[model samples]
Structure formats: C-alpha cells, structure tokens
Target: MTERPADEKDIVLAAQRGEQAAFSELVRRHQRRAYAVARAIVINHEDAEDAVQEAFLHAYRAIDRFLPDQAFGAWLHRIVANAALDVTRRRKVRDADELPETVASPFRDPAEKGELRARLTEALNTLPARQRAVIVLHDVEGYKHAEIGQMLDIPEGTARSDLHYARSQLRQVLGALRQS
Candidate 1:
C-alpha cells in the first residue's frame, strides 16, 4: 500500500522540526501562487522571480516561527507580496532620474489580440503596486477582498477601494487606446 501525501499542516509540523524534504514540499505546493502574487506586484518577470526566490529563502529561515494552525499559503503570500513591493521600490529609486515618457499609441489595430494584451499590460504597469496587487488578486486570481486584505496587511475596505481605483484607471487607459 502506498502512503498518502502529507497535508499542509503536517508538512509544516515536519518542517518546523528541521525536515528539509517537508520544507521542499511546502515550496512545491505554494511556488506558483507565490510567483503569481510577486509577478502581479512587480510587473517584471525577472524581478518577480527574484522576489519569489527571496520570499522562499526568508520563509525557510523563519519556518520555525510558523504556527501550524495558521494557513501557510496566506503567510507565504504576505512574504512574497512584500518582497515584490520591495523590488518595485528599488526599481522606482533606480528610475527616479529618468524623465517620464508620454507616448500616445499611434492607432494600433484593436482587432489584434496581441496588441490588446500589450495595451492591457502597459496599463497595468502604470498602476501603483498596491492597486496592481488589488486588481490582480481580486480580478485575475479571483481572491476575495478579505483574503487580499490579509495578504497585503490592509483593511478589506481598502482592498475594495484599491480595486475600484485600479479598474477606473484601466478603463481610462483602454478608452484612450480605443480613441487612438
């Protein structure tokens, strides 16, 4: 008979006791989610990947401090989000000396799917990190405001408001695309 795979709580318990394999299991279970959360905030693939790796390193070191009763995914989510935000902050600092570009799109064909996706990406990149996180978590990932609040350490109302603001911003950007 084959042994059943350990559940998250069991894995956490084992990891807390200095089990390397158990910790690896936790990383395997949550890596995609961690990357998605990081990517949504940082907006650059390499930066997001770096942030997720940093988050996992931090989690591994802090695994002993983890409470078994708490949801590990939620805890990891917070770490990845913070790391991604740090990447964004560092990027902003680096780009501070550059002049902002005000390029209006020159009549791209709306019927082209690639063009639409590119435009959407451009719009998302313009949002503040928190607003981008709110939009991606709530709209793209289908996470509720309460969960987003926990992950981002904000009130649920703030998550909702950020989502509202982000949607409004995207609408304006898309509207400009349509007009152009």
Candidate 2:
C-alpha cells in the first residue's frame, strides 16, 4: 500500500509528543486492519473488538518504544495479534469446546454458502490451534511467513510447515465434503 500522507509523520510526531488527537487519528487509520487481525485469531467479533481496543491502549503506553523506521501499521498489528492470542489462551482454559471459525466468503448465495461454510468450519475445527492460526494468518489473511512467525513466536520454517500440514488436512476434509 502507498505510504500514509506525509502529514502522518506529523501525526506520529504529535502523538509521540502526547497529543490525544494525533493518537486518535492513528487509531482511526489503523483500526480496521487491527480488528481484522484480532478477529482472525480470536474468532468471536466482540472479543476481537475488545482485543483491538486493548491493543491500542497497550500501543499508546508503549509508543515511546516504537521504532519510527518500521511502519506503524505493522507495529500496531503485532500488538493487536498478541492481544488477540492472549484472549484466545485465556478462553481456552475456560472453554473446552471452543473452536475457531472458518474463513468464509460473504458474497455467496445464502443456502449454498451455509452448506459450504459448515463443511469448511468442521474441517478447520479439526486442525490444532497452532496450525489453524498459521493457516489463517498466512493463507486467509495474506501475511508473509516471516510476519506470521514473528506474531506467533515461531520460526519461519515452522510457519511454513504448519501451513503445509494445514493445507493437507484441509484438502482431506474438503475432499470428503465433495464425496459426501
């Protein structure tokens, strides 16, 4: 994507100077991507929103440590992803039956979409959490393997392997769906 307006640098500088309006503008600019990353990990919309909000708070507190050389969006996304994973970890301890939702297209016809989605969701649920996260991040979310590795604290090789395994599993599941 093209760089944010040159004024964004000014906003960042102002935000770093503790200007609330500048910080709010940063939030407004980045919130959608942050929420998408969070929602991809956390599954539940409400929890993802909460995670994004918490991430913004955390990012604000840690803004002093943010490296200006790096893109602000990537940094904020890392925060949101971590917060979302944290939420998932906590929820896992409380809910044994929890499963991540399938990544689905919304533009399809309702009845056919529902059936296909149900099959895909079942397949996704059968994969382990780490594999699911890797697949969703790298495949559905279009994150680079290195970025996914950094977010999940795994090696790039590990992310790649997980994605491979996830694809194999998904293929098997999807094949069964076709057969049925």
Candidate 3:
C-alpha cells in the first residue's frame, strides 16, 4: 500500500528525528511568511532575504530542540525576528541602487502616499529593535500579545507595553509630520 501524505505534525516529527527532507519541506512551507516577517523588521529587500536565509539555517540547526506541542510558525517567527535584528546590527544597510532617471522621475506615485510611507518608515526606524519587533509583529503581522511575548521570550505584559510605546512614538512623530 502507498504511504499517506505527511501532515505538518508528521513533518515536524520527521524533522525532529533529523530528516533533512522533512526540514526542507518545513522551510518551503514557511519561507514566504518568514520573508514577510523579516521584511517588516529589516525594511530592506536584500537584508530581509538574508535574514530569512539565516533564520532557516539556525532553525535547521536547532530543530531538535523544538517542542512538538508548540506552534512551529511561532517558533520559526521568533528566529526570523532575531535574525532580522542581527542583520541590522551586523552591518550598515546599503543604499538602494537607483538610476538618475528614476530618481528624478516626475511620474512617481502620489506625493501624499509617498510622503506618508517615508514618514512611517522613519518613525519605525527610530524605535529600539525589540519595540520595532513587538509593534511590527503585533500590528503589521497581526500576532497576539501573548504570541509576541512567546516569540520574543518576554512577559506578555512587556509585549503589550512595548507595543504601546512603539505606537505612541510613531504617532507622535508622524503626527508632527502631518501638521507641518
């Protein structure tokens, strides 16, 4: 008889047993969400990609320690968040390569939208790394405070506090931009 398809639990179990193909399957499954998580933190395309790669390698190395009862997506996101923070600290972010025509283009997107995006990005950058992680994980990525705390290895209260402060700071900064 043919074998049944492996479910996520089966995949994790196989991975825990050191099955390389199983781990590869896990990576394939989570890579897009992982990239989104990394991108939200790093705010740069190449750096986010690097973070995802590094996180997967780290996860592969540490997969044996993963508790099967826990949520694998949560566990993986925690690593991805840390990897993005690490990437930011490891080197200065490179400037995007833009052609002069593109840079000088008068046909860019609407001014208000561009300005708002720039302001939001600037505000996010001002936050401390953990605060950024908390806010982005909670707000942008739609993780609960408890899930964020677990991913960040902080108390749930701390995650809530961090998110509050991060949001407050963003509002203050971006609010000022709107008035001026």
| Worst 10 contiguous positions by lDDT, candidate 3 | 91-100
Give TM per candidate.
0.90, 0.79, 0.81
Winner by TM-score between candidate 3 and candidate 2:
3
lDDT of each: 0.90, 0.82, 0.83
| Residue pairs in clash, model 3 | none
Worst 10 residues of 1 by lDDT: 1-10
Query: Quick one: best lDDT, which candidate?
Result: 1
- Candidate 2 structure lDDT: 0.82
Better of 1 and 2 by lDDT: 1
- Report the candidate with higher lDDT, 1 versus 3: 1
* Poorly placed runs, candidate 1 (over 4 Å): 1-5, 98-107, 111-113
What's the residue-level lDDT of 94 in candidate 1?
88
lDDT of 2 by residue, 25-130 (tens): 8999999888888877776789899899999999999988887777788788878878988888787797878665786564445367477767777688778767
Q: Rank the candidates by lDDT, best first.
A: 1, 3, 2
Clashing pairs in 1: none
For model 2, the superposed segments whose C-alpha errors exceed 4 Å read 1-7, 97-113, 177-180
